[model samples]
Target: MTLTLTSLGGAGTVTGSRHLLEYEGRRILIDCGLFQGYKALRQRNWAPFPIDPKSIDAIVLTHA
Candidate 1:
């Protein structure tokens, strides 16, 4: 089984925390947050998700 982690958002920036984990044909997403603060960061919210939302098997939110 191979486990791969991809950062969909919140890498260089401080907001929009979203990470994708794939293992054993299962895709799990960690944190589905929105970008806040500056206009540039907030604009990211308008962008489409890197992957299909229905493709995600599960979602693990760390906080509300």
Candidate 2:
């Protein structure tokens, strides 16, 4: 089996938030979270994820 890793969020921003993932045969989501401050940031919390939540395998969080 081959694993493909990707980052879904937190490319340049801080907040210690990031979404690292490996998906190919199996779909997985890393840190899916909301950042503090900024209305857009907060909105992401309620917004629908790009990938279906049901498809996510695990949610890895670096910090709260």
lDDT winner among the candidates?
1
Global lDDT scores for all candidate models: 0.94, 0.63
TM-score, structure 1 vs. true = 0.95
lDDT of 1 by residue, 15-62 (tens): 899999999999999999899999989999999988999999999999
Q: Which run of 10 residues does model 2 get worst, by summed lDDT? A: 11-20
Q: How does residue 42 of candidate 1 score in lDDT?
A: 95
Off by over 4 Å in 1: none
Query: Alpha-carbon error at 55 in model 2, in Å?
Result: 0.9
Model 2 misplaced regions, further than 4 Å: 16-20
Question: Candidate 1: RMSD over Cα atoms?
Answer: 0.7
Root-mean-square deviation per candidate = 0.7, 2.6
